[model samples]
Target: MTYRIGYIVGSLSSVSINRRLAGALVALAPDTLEFFEIGIADLPLYNRDLDGDYPEVARRFKGDVESADGLLIVSPEYNRSMPGALKNAIDWGSRPWGTNSFARKPTALLGTSSGSIGTAVMQAAMRNVLSFLNVPQLSSPEAYITFKPDEWDGDMVTNESTRAFLTHYMAEFAAFVERVLAHAPGHIGDEG
Candidate 1:
């Protein structure tokens, strides 16, 4: 009755607001859902030539995505788009010419920023790429928020409204994950 989700945080910074948001999601998630950060910092910039003999790091990242039941991506807008590290990871996941690891996986996106835009354009760019990768992303109840430092008490969001909304979204994500697993071919509801 547990679902393991492989997650990606677009920023490499230790103090990334988007990374904090992802951690908050984990704290709010139902017991049935567990998250593991899929590290992308070690991956080289994806090159097609490297696809034939992928580095062990890239292969491990791909395996993490393939083994997991779903994906959770939290990205902050960088230059009006997702960060380079995350994009490189995505390219690595969908590689070797028709051997994409992310194909048909259930996914969700969330992010926060200091600005009013709240990662909207970054998410849009990500959506286009994920569409090509065949990742079925949740379309409703999106979390795009302006970061408020005063609202965070340690890793948890102290603001009542933000906490409430995130809690509800995590519950919904639990159900979405369940449905994705139930319908996945050969899934026996115990996939890691």
Candidate 2:
């Protein structure tokens, strides 16, 4: 019952706290989910002029979006909005007009930040984008973490409450993915 999930992160810094938070989730994700991080750092800034003949990277990224059953977005607040790289990835996946790869794909938003805001505003912006693509998103059990540097010892999320919270959150997201797959055309796990 494993679901393939396309993953994206909002930060590009070499020592991004957002990346570490995503790593923690990866280490904690359940067996029912298989994550594949799609690197957006290599993508050129999205431009409509290139839509007619998308770059190799753009085509590959679209293919990645199409093949996955769902998406898991990990973000950090950047000046009260989503990072440009992540926004560019979304734009690339949404285009060439009426061929959005994300339409109807189940998605969830999880984010962390040192500030109290915790990417709430950024996720809101993403919500509007995904809504336009007709993608389904998880709205319950929100993750808006204010990260602490001392909260881990490599990969593991050491805080007991945070670990417990994420364990349940993953289970909830797994259920959401199942519901989405059941509703999708040519649902993957269906048996005729």
Candidate 3:
């Protein structure tokens, strides 16, 4: 059975390394998993006024999150926290209060930074937010990445050791997703 996985890019820039990592992970997806890129950049900020008259963009964003069996967020840390754009996207989806798109969905976080901390701290911040959203995240073999700006290209995960780690991370993430879907209420196979 195929699972629809939404890969969210936290940064909007065309050259964003975080986005590139998400794309690379998608490329590694097996035939049973279909990866969809969730366009977070194009969304407008959350507004109660707009909620009643939902824009096409908002509807699509909500649909993507709602339809996916799980989510993969390639977060980029900004000032040691999750980027505003990424946080905003989640805020939008977690609304019309109590009917969050992410409710009960499985999510995995992977992040990269030019600094030594990678995205460890941001993940901590996100853990709080995820708790509020009631989203179930993969809990083992936590995925994290750090890279030196001088050593890598925009799209290629060229650091050999980092690449190997990320490859292993993706495989584990896929299995975690399968396990999550297997047990979620009413989530059975492709129907998820």
TM-score of each: 0.94, 0.93, 0.89
Give the per-residue lDDT digits (tens) of candidate 3, residues 12-47. Answer: 887787877786677665666788888888888878
Q: Which pairs of residues collide in candidate 2?
A: none
Candidate 1: the clashing residue pairs are none
How many collisions per candidate? 0, 0, 0
Model 2: how far residue 24 lies from native, Å: 1.5
RMSD, one per candidate, in order: 3.3, 3.8, 3.4
What local lDDT score does residue 109 receive in model 3, on the 0 to 100 scale? 88
List lDDT for all candidates, in order.
0.86, 0.83, 0.79
Clashes of 1: 0
Per-residue lDDT of 92-155 in model 2, one digit per residue for the tens? Answer: 9888886788887888888988888778888888888778778889999898888877987776
Question: Regarding lDDT, does 2 or 3 come out ahead?
Answer: 2
Candidate 3: C-alpha RMSD after superposition = 3.4
Candidate 3: TM-score?
Answer: 0.89
lDDT of 1 by residue, 62-114 (tens): 88988888899999999999899999999888887667888878899979999
Better of 1 and 3 by lDDT: 1
Better TM-score candidate (1, 2): 1
Number of the top lDDT candidate: 1
Model 1 TM-score on a 0 to 1 scale: 0.94
